[model samples]
Target: MSGRKLRQLKEAMATILDDLNRGDLFSIVVFSEKVEVWDPALGEAEMQDNLGRLRDWTESTTDAERSGTPAPSVITAITLENTNKAKRFVQNLTTYSATNIHGALMKALQILEVGRSASPEQTNHAEERPEPMIIFLTDGQANVGVSDTFRIVSSVTAANAGNSSIFSLALGNGADFPFLKKLSLRNSGFARKIYEASDTALQLTDFYRQVASPLLANVTFRYQPDQVEPQSVTRLAFRRFFSGSELVVAGRLHGNNVTGEVQAHSSSGSARYPFDPVILPTTPTANTMERLWAYLTIQQLLEDDDASTSPGKQRALELALTYSFVTPLTSLVVVRPDNETRPVEPEEASFAAADRSRAPSHVSPVSLSSFPVQGAAKTSHNAYSRILPGGYQDMRPISSSGAYYADLILPAYPVSTSASLDDILWLSPNDTTVSLPTGVNGTSEVLNLATADETNAAYAACVTPGGQPGHCRHLKYCVLLTFLNNQTEFLPFFCRIDSFVGVCCQDDS
Candidate 1:
């Protein structure tokens, strides 16, 4: 082998492991000067002394034989059905010289064809096939082969028109776009140019997440009359996918009034599966559809360009991550005060003030929203008062700190209406359930009690707040416990209270 890019290839291998561990399967073939499978096949060893077998396989193979056919020897050794074995086989192999990308794809396609022979036997039951997927990386153009790049790409594309998906990533400089783009489109694959080798793993991970465990396999989209045309929706695609041993498919209802259904057929059983006709009235625009569109577009671009500069790749990433609606980064969001049930609005001025305080001595203060958390207090005053909204703590007054019991006011909430201290087995209330608990205006010494039912839990105030050695609340306090499906091992539950105790200033006037 000649012209092997060891470091870049290792980075690619690491990414394959990370993605496959998460249930995404992809084959990697890197091309530089020549091509070789990152993973090689090994015959069963008769004895431990057979370490010589690997060395002989590595050092003795001639370049002509190794690169002889468009299909590398690896094709005969790996198939979709034996993919797991292929994985183990690759793990034990070493990197080889040359990065012949087209050669690598040719080898991979040959490997995949073998799947048709060894594919798992399908029963009358719902059938599924291992998702057909391929990923290719290259830093140079097609130089060592007698085959024209365009012809190879066209053939691969025509083959993929029926099944399998291909995605390509080009790293550093020397990428060939004309060849890459055709290859990507032929198989519905993507090609991207990465400016640096470092970004390969991250880019690969993103690619895998977008296509892995497809919700619908062998899936396609079609349009109906009177419904909006499919092309009008800029980024119509699957937002999330669920996987089993069967086929995967996901969809969104187009326009608010538009109606349609998602259908899938298991390759094994040839069973037609259908999801509810998704209907939407609101017309989707490019900006709104960018995320889903990003997945496919990024795939195509990565296959075509080698734009791996930090800022350049970042722009690609922002697009890719946005469209990857299935990943966690696209899922979680923190609630703002206005959007949540918090009473106090977040102060904008405080954010600016905090930023100014942290600015460098010689530099003007940059406005910021909050100070960073450290072991010591950044502000002199009341820093300890910061509390988690809707959170509870076992609070006690400190005499050494000169803290005094003051009126603690908890607002009336849903818990007051439904939970009584006795119902939760909290502190024992007078044991009488109140028809209606007293609201803020109606004041009485007795706290109204409520009962827990089948869905809700019984809450009673435990004299001990800790549920162990015990603590206390001065106000009429109680404990509440909820039983989910009647299974109780003391799961943490929330409580709401109305009455609070506080210290008031004696009127000198």
Candidate 2:
């Protein structure tokens, strides 16, 4: 977090205080290596002693670290004086240490007076407590106590007595947007990224305004069990529905229509609304609709993923830690609940991989499928990944023969994906082999063991950094290129040719 952003944040906090009324109760908890819960109602000595006890009960620490302990959760009501005091505390705040996200959140939940438990369990009559929500803001990665991202989320979720909505603000660039988003989503809330600009403070207060007014709580969307696939329904149970926001429901019906209902609790009393036989126009093909659902499902897994978008990227790896959830980065290893192995298997140092033959019946196993766990954070940015057709051809000349170029034959390929072949220009004969992969990147595999398996291969257009778009083709297939010998018989005859990609760039007639 930069100094300028810090000042902006303080300003935003003051603005939030100004907006609060007596009906709202709040607490201020800051975390570095330790947590400090500022309760204006309590004296400094009393606050320190109370915090010391809370620390001793939760973690293992020494007397020296006791001073860093935060005071216990106080039932402090919002008031002009208290808000002013809190503003002073925020303005005077200037300290630095490791980021203990887990501890900070735990303290916040404690202040909300939510039921605390060591492990997650069923909560009955959860509506009895006051409507609780936390507007959490943080920058930087977790480095201190319980730095594990998933564990931090899971633990806080387990301890949530009132099931509070946690709207997280990921301020500044490189603020681990994925982590904050996940944390918010799991708690029936959402996350927003705050750009570090002149109006950053405004961004903070504006987001606060969105979740500030609650219209409904414990909202549930229901559909006839027989009408829709139960597994296909996404986000049926939401924590709360604010006045300005609308609920989104998406699912496939068994027939043309399905009956559904919305059940929730409002200020007056319990509320229920019926939505029977909802019919939607289907002018598109079944395939297109299927793709729509598939894309929607995919959006959840690879949410807000931009690391692999650049054409310069050569490879990407998603490792699992704590639990296998739909997230971007992981630091620790955990038991993988599911295994995603590619259908193609390696045998005798060679394997038959899918090629440009048919539309993908299913997504590639290499792609990350999101499996949300209870209390896991929501992810942003769906990752856009395309299958690379195996690897570049080893198109090197063994001998030189005068072969003339003729008409081109674009091989049998799968879908065009982002574009179609147009303005196909023959590659320059002077264009010699450079490095491996040939064009930018999608995967980092080599075709050393297998021939360009046409029957089962994934094909797509690959462009170089120089804006030269072309396809990988065999040298023997690329007109008659004279090699040292019958080099066409060996692997050195393959090269990514210019223009149309696939079996041949220009047919050697």
Q: Which of the numbered candidates is closest to the native, going by highest lDDT?
A: 2
Candidate 2 regions with alpha-carbon error over 4 angstroms: 42-73, 114-129, 277-281, 284-292, 301-509
Summarize candidate 2's per-residue lDDT along 470-507 as a digit string, tens digits: 34444323332222122111122233222222332222
lDDT of each: 0.35, 0.48
Over 4 Å off in model 1, which ranges?
Answer: 1-5, 18-99, 119-127, 146-148, 158-162, 197-199, 222-224, 228-256, 266-509
Name the lDDT of candidate 1.
Answer: 0.35
Taking the tens digit of each residue's C-alpha lDDT, what string does model 1 give over 1-509? 11334354554465455445322223344344444443334444511233113211121247665434332323332234445444444444454434455556655665565443332332112144455567666666666553477677766666553355666665545667556756765575545544342223433443444455555543433334454434323223322222411111112223333333343444353233332332222333322222223433343344444445545345455543433321111222223435442223233221111111111111111111111112111211111112111111122232332221222342221122233343533233464422111111111122233333112222222112122221212122332323212111111221222222111111110
Q: Provide the lDDT at 56 for model 2.
A: 30
What TM-score, over all chains together, does every model reach?
A: 0.40, 0.51
